[model samples]
Target chain A: MVKPMTKTKFLERLGAELGIPPATLREEAPLNSFKAWDSMGHMSVLAMIDAELGCEVPPGALQKCKTVGDLVALVGSKLES
Target chain B: MITQIASHLPRTVLANEGLAQLYPDWTAEKIFEKTGIRERHVVDEGECASDLAFAAAERLFAGRAREADYLLFCTQTPDYLLPTTACVLQHRLGLPTTCAALDFNLGCSGYIYGLSLANSLLQSGAANRVVLLTADTYSRLIHPQDKSTRTIFGDAGTATLLSKESGSRLHSFVLGSDGSGAEQLMVKTNGARFPRADGLPTTTDESGNVHDPACLYMNGPEIFNFTLKAVPKLVREVLEKAKLSLDQIDLVVFHQANAFMLEHLRRKLGIAPEKFVLHLEHCGNTVSSTIPLALEGVITTGRLKPGMKVLLAGFGVGYSWGGCILEW
Candidate 1:
């Protein structure tokens, strides 16, 4: 059985992948505010999510996410489903 | 067996700095970092694919214009739809009137498919020598203001000579296609389904790139996703058919789509950096000419040696993909 990833764990992993401090990733932090959040960065995020969370997130999913919390929720929903 | 290869790039050059002038938000450094393309060759206003193909073939004929029993020209941009471009090339190159010639319409994956066709011809005793030519002027199809396609595509032509030799070996090919994703990378107009009509409005996308129904359109994310799903299967199939493992292969050459995507594919496949061939910095994606151009680079640079096993794979435009192994 696969265990659901917690919000704390997800934030930690995402921060590592994006090279951001976990504390800096506030709930309402805008995704575009990050200097590394470009097309290549988006691909890295997708690859990291698949590698760490075992969830396949499409590129379209990232486009729909505006804030850090929204991205976490997207991945969490995929995990739960 | 591929005996000789020659390529021709147009004289006009479009540097990244020139492109930066069009899109102020993106600098040349940013563009190069994103695409690994510093510059691309652009054809003159009146230049066509046939013109470029003729130049490349002429270069190969400089030493000696040997007569070929057959000529196969691969391209999407032909001089005319009625008469085949290959037929025109035979006359332009001064080949015998008895030579057989035809053109195949494909992009990106055209090189591998051409090799497969040429190999089949030699094996079946259809032709003693074959001249496989690939050329495209995608620059002509691109809108001046469209940065997406403009930054990634360049104009080029390549000619490769294949002849039968004792103990020459070419492995079987593994090819695949999924037309359901065809629209992901295509020109919506100027074809049979959607003929070009005047007064078509131009629309701009979120990236600030303008597009007309007649111009080329590409969904980067969708193409990337399709590649991710297809290339792994392609690599494995070719390796299986050749009875070789990843470590046994000396070189792996894939379509020069972009630096970012090619590096990602290399890492995903666990291929070593030295074993992989990447030459897109000088000329951006030349569609069908990419593989042969890269092959020419490795050979000229002395990286590809005799007795080395090379794996060639191409994927894109038609959502088409193919793989084959060559014993050099």
Candidate 2:
């Protein structure tokens, strides 16, 4: 069985995928503030979400996210459980 | 069996440093870490996919081009929308007039599909030897400043010669596609469905990558998700069809899409690092040429040898995917 992915784990994984230092990222951080959140980084985030949580975030849905918190919400909504 | 495999890259080279100069935020090391692409070759002004294909085929043939009884050219970027590129290649290569030749539009999954066709033609006694050429100059289809694509794709063509043999065989293949996800990675214009319009419209996405209606557009996350779902299943189905397990496959080579994705799949599928092959560091994603190029690399390095069971999987573009086991 897979570990239940918590919001904290989700953000940490997302930050790791984007190459963000662990303690440097705040939950309310704007998604656009990070230089690594470019197109490739965007793809990495979604892949990370799917790999870490097994939830495929629709590309359009990702486009709607403004803050890292919004991304967490989008991912949480798509969780299989 | 694939008797020989040859690959060709265009003259112009685009290194990550070149890309970093354009997109300052990305350093060469940073780009390499993410994509595992150091440099990619692109075609020059007068060059095209066919030219590269011709060159690679010439090298593959080495004056034996006339022995081919059939020719198959796999590409998405054909020279002309009218006469098929394979026909022109046949004549240019001096293949016999009786040879059956045609072009099939496929991307990363092309080499597998080409091998499948060659297998059919040989098994049916339709042809004695098949010239399978997979080439694509995706650089022609990409927007100039689209860092996402420019950093990932490079142009290349590869020629693989296949012939029926008693000892070695091209085993069964598991091929797949999903058109519903076609828009995820595609070029929207320059086709019968949507002819080119003047003043190509462009849009800038949140990632700052430009989307030109006339150039390539890849929804990276969507394709990644598709791969995450499709590839493992494809691997399982192919293994079942062959009645073999992962340990039995001597080597595994998948399309060199990107380093991150390939590394992820390698781990997710429980594929051992030493058994897997990655040739993307220099060539980047050469579309259809990737698998063959990787094969050629391993062959030269002695990683692939006669009697070894090699598993090849190609997935992407057309949302197409395929897997097959070959006795090398």
Candidate 3:
């Protein structure tokens, strides 16, 4: 059985994918604020989530995520199911 | 055997700085860093695909113009809907009237498809000499304010000569399509389904890029995901068909979609940087012309040599994808 991903782990993974510092990835951090959060970054995040969580994050759903917490919650919900 | 390839780009150049003025949020450097494209050649007003195609074919001829047995012109943007562009080209290029010529509609995957058709024609003994031409003026089909499509597309034409040989260097091909993803990258209007008379209103997407219903619209993320899922499988299939491993191939030439997507696919496939052709910095995605343009670049630069095996892959715009191997 796979372990449930924690918020901290999710942030770390996303940070690595986006080339952002983990310390800067607070739950309230605005995703668009990061220079790396462009179209390519969005695709990389989706790939990272798929690789790390084994869940395919739809591009539409990924686009709906505005804050770091939203992304974590999106992945966490998918993980629960 | 594949004899020679020649490509022609429009004289007008659109640099990143010119695009930066349209999208103030992104600087020229940022655009270059993101797309790996510094500039693209765009056709001037009144120039069409056939003009570019004619120029490329003329260059390929260069006093060696001969009567081709068949002419294959591949493009989504034809000079006219009626009377195939190839027929016009045959007349314009001074090919014999006895030659068979036709137009096939495809986008980025066109070059590979053209090769497959040429190879088949040669194998079947239907044609001794095949002139495969790929050209597009996608710039005319894009909305001026749509930066997503505007920044990435360039106008170009390419002509490749194929002749029958007992030991033909052109080998296996793997082609695929997903029509369901057609809407993801398409011009919703000006087609049989949605006539221009319908007058669909121009709208803007979340990215601030405006789209006229007749203009080209690309869902970048969806296309990226589709490529990620399709290309590796396509590569593997071609390799399997050729009974060769990836390492055995001398070089991989893919459609010049953009720098970011190409880099991502390259890393995913574990292809060595030097073994991969990256020539699109000077001419953004030229739709059907990209692969042949890259092939010409590699040959001119001496990166590709005679007897070397090359893997060619092209994907986009039809959600069409194809891969093939050729011995240079």
Model 3 clashing residue pairs (backbone) = none
Estimated TM-score for each candidate: 0.89, 0.93, 0.91
What local lDDT does model 2 show for residue B121?
A: 89
State the DockQ of every prediction.
0.26, 0.52, 0.36
Q: Rank all candidate structures by their DockQ, best first, as comma-separated numbers.
A: 2, 3, 1
Report per-prediction Cα RMSD to one decimal. Answer: 3.3, 2.3, 3.1
lDDT of 3 by residue, B141-195 (tens): 8898988888899999999999875343887799999887888898887778887
Clashing pairs in 2: none
State each model's CA lDDT, in order: 0.86, 0.86, 0.87
Pick by TM-score: 1 or 2, better one? 2
For candidate 2 chain A, the 10 contiguous residues with the lowest summed lDDT are A1-10
Predicted candidate 2 versus true structure: per-residue lDDT over A1-81, tens digit per residue: 135677767767887888787677777899898877776777778667666666756546786788887887787765434
- For model 1, what is the alpha-carbon lDDT of residue B322? 89
Stretches of candidate 1 off by over 4 Å are A1-44, A47-81, B166-168, B197-201
lDDT by residue (tens digit), candidate 1, B1-328 = 8888899999999999999998888899988988999999989989989888899999888887668999999999999877998998899899999899999999989999999999999989999889999999999888888887899999999998898962446785999888887887788887787787467788986556788879888777667767777898899999999889999999999999999789878977889999999989989999999999999999899998989999999999998988899888
| Overall local distance difference test of candidate 1 | 0.86
